[model samples]
Target: MAFVALSEAEKVYIVHGVQEDLRMDGRGCEDYRCVEVETDVVSNTSGSARVKLGHTDILVGVKAEMGTPKLEKPNEGYLEFFVDCSANAAPEFEGRGGDDLGTEIANTLYRIFNNKSSIDLKSLCINPREHCWILYVDVLLLECGGNLFDAISIAVKAALFNTRIPRVRVLEDEEGLKDIELSDDPYDCIQLSVENVPCIVTLCKIGYRHVVDATLQEEACSLASLLVSVTSKGVVTCMRKAGKGSLDPESIFEMMEVRLVLGRCLDLAGSAGCLLPPWSHCGNSPH
Candidate 1:
């Protein structure tokens, strides 16, 4: 997360605005900033996407690589998440400075998608305990204003939506050795079902109110925040409290209510309209 220095008076002003349901940017407490999403941004990757939320920019690429299946889940494939906080986002993120934050964000992503309901891993398997497709989702942070988690999660989901894995066949010879062959036709691929993929929504608690998709300035005024990941059907897959301030039980519940509504809205909006392919309008590329 990028740091923003705010004076006491400036913090009070922002907090007052939130209390009145009019944030600094004129959005309601539950409103989000303008978001731009583009799919297949990187040509070499199996899937890629770029998402800009406010001034925060993120690029996500997913590469499907063949690997042996895990012993515990031999019939299923898996997702590996890696987040790189580039120095371009902030000078403080240079070299090893941003490693801790990147690790934290990556762990959060893992927790959010740590369920069978989120993805059909079995569909990625070629043979039980033998071979499977491993999707390596890599996130690159280009800029940071605020709402880093939300933007990254959105970008990841969009990248997954755009991903296509080549169809492969396993053949056994007379010696009982199996050989894998990739499909010759590029169009002959499998697309992952992203309907159940969850998007994260982070709510920043300011004064007596909480705001969604807060700006960098607004974040400086907030003492605590909540992160909630919800599926398209409004099912919360993971929830966690972040920041230094502690919230009472009642406040926690209140935040959960707000998270539910905002999460559902995000899911519907993202899945229904925001994630359209880049060439859908220009008719230049095949979807």
Candidate 2:
């Protein structure tokens, strides 16, 4: 995200407020903006979710396809993350304009999921190296408000939780020919275990203090921000520094502590309150 210009006086005011544990929006240092999450919002995908955090809007779709397993992990399936910054979000994203930003965000997601702790790829496999389910997690940015990473991660987690992959069995005869058979009941399916899926929390360093989930206006007043990905169990998976200005090592350590604390809150609230599985909701899309 590009930085916006803020007057010197405004910057000083924001910094002073942060030193007092307050912000322009009245949220404390660790408080997050209101989050709205809806599952199965799109019809074509096997699972989908839309999350709106303040002004940042993100949509995630999961499509399961059968494909050959990778050589390194022949017994496991994997996830492909694609981030599309749609023109609908902003006129700046028209045509291929958003390609650069999209690629950057997609790469971050790939790195975050590189560890086995993030997702159970082996469970997605149907038949060792012969057959496996590849989940294509496509994320669409509907708005470019500040804190895009955090919103996108939340949406992705919700969509995966909503995914229901149908049960398929392969039948082999004495001749060694294989036949794929779908489950007798269409409703019988498997759900991905997203208990370890991580959520990205962005902390913008404004003035002398930092804040989480900063809006675009607030982001404009800040110099740099830290991106931290944390799992539902409060485990930190990835961390990176974003934006223009540099951050001190001591401040970075302080921000990490705050990120972990806030991450736990978001995980508990989002999973229990907003991230409902499709079966639990009777397959009805949360419009």
Candidate 3:
């Protein structure tokens, strides 16, 4: 998250606004800022997407490469997530300054997709214990306003929705040597099922209430926050408490309830509504 310095009076003003359910941007406590999603932005990658949530901008690219399957999951392929905080987004992220934040965001992404229900990994297997498709999902932070996790997760899901892996077949000769052949037609490809994909919702605790999609100024007034990963069906796959402050048990439960509603709304908005631009809305959009 990008740092913003606020004075004591500014913090109090923001905190008071949150308590009254009226944010500085005129949004309610649970309302999100305008989100814009565009897919297939990078031509070279298998799939790519760029998402803008208020001032925070993120771009995600997924490249499918051939690799040997893991020993433990020989029949299934895997997804890898990496986050790069470009210095262009913030000068403070120049050099190695952003590595820690990038690693932390990447790890959180891994945890959110660790479950089998999130993606059909077995479909990526080219050959049992021999070859498989490794989807390297790379996220680049172009800007930061607030709610980094939620924006990144949305971009990732959109990129995965746009991903198309070249179909391949395994052939064995009489000598038992194996060879892989890619589909001749470029249009003949495999698309992953993002139906069960989960989106992240970060709820920041400000004053006696919690808010979603907090801007940098509002984030400065927050003490602790909760990160919740929820699927389209409103099932929570993972939850974590973030920040350096303590949350009471009652507040934790209250945040969980809010997470479910907001998560479902996000899922529905991305799937059925106009999350993607009107021109880009096609059969390939997430459903």
Candidate 4:
């Protein structure tokens, strides 16, 4: 996140505003900052999406490769999450310095997707124990405004929605050797159901109140923040805290209430059906 200097009076004003359930942007406590989502933006990847929440920008690319199924889940395929905090986001993240934060974010994603309900892993299996499609979800951090976890989560969800797993056919000979064939038509593919995918909402505690979709400057003034992942149907998937300070149980519960309200709006707004650009024609491209 960029370091913006804020005077003591400005900080006090923000704190007072939050305590009264309002923000500088004129949004209520549960309102999220504007989010821009674009899918299939990168041609090099099988699936790609870019999401800009407030000023936090994140891009996700998914590549599918044939691999053996895991021993524990032979009948199911798996997803590998990789997050890269590039220097474009911050100079401090230039090399191995960002690896730790990237790993932490990736691990959190893995944990969020641990349940079978999140994705249909079995559909990715080709031959049960022999071959399966391993989905590599790579998240690239382009910018960090304030709520990084929320932005990345939205990008991941959009990328997964845009993912198209190529149709493959398996042939077994008399010798039991398996041959895999890709579909001739590139359009013949399967799209994942993103309805169950969750979006994260981070609530930062300021003064005696909490605010959603906080800006980088607001985040700097916050003591602690709650990260909540909520699906479209109002189901809470995972929860965590990312900050140097601790939060009281009462504040945590209060944050959850705001998270639920914000999650529903995001879930509806971020849905595939809602993302079809109104003015964009099917065959139109900006010159």
Candidate No. with top TM-score: 3
Enumerate residue pairs that collide in model 4: none
Give the TM-scores of the predictions, in the order they appear: 0.93, 0.90, 0.94, 0.91
lDDT of 1: 0.85
Model 1 Cα displacement at 285 (Å)?
34
Q: Encode model 2's per-residue lDDT on 76-156: one tens digit a residue.
A: 999998888888787778989899899989999998899998889988888887889999999999887778988888888
Pick by lDDT: 2 or 3, better one: 3
Q: Which ten residues in a row have the lowest lDDT in candidate 2?
A: 278-287
RMSD of 2: 5.6
Locate the minimum summed-lDDT window of 10 residues in model 4.
278-287
Q: Quick one: RMSD of model 3?
A: 4.2
Clashes of each: 0, 0, 0, 0
Off by over 4 Å in 1: 269-287
* Reference-based lDDT, residue 14, model 2: 78
Runs in model 3 lying further than 4 Å from the true structure = 269-287
lDDT digits (tens) for residues 1-287 of candidate 3:
67899999999999999999888988778778777888889999999989888899999999999998999999999998889999988788999879999999999989988989999999999998999999999999999899999989888988898899999988999999999999989899998888888999999999899988899999889889999999978999998988899899999998888777667656654443237333123212111
Q: Model 2 segments beyond 4 Å from truth?
A: 2-9, 273-287
Cα lDDT, model 4, residue 200:
84
lDDT to native, each model? 0.85, 0.81, 0.86, 0.81
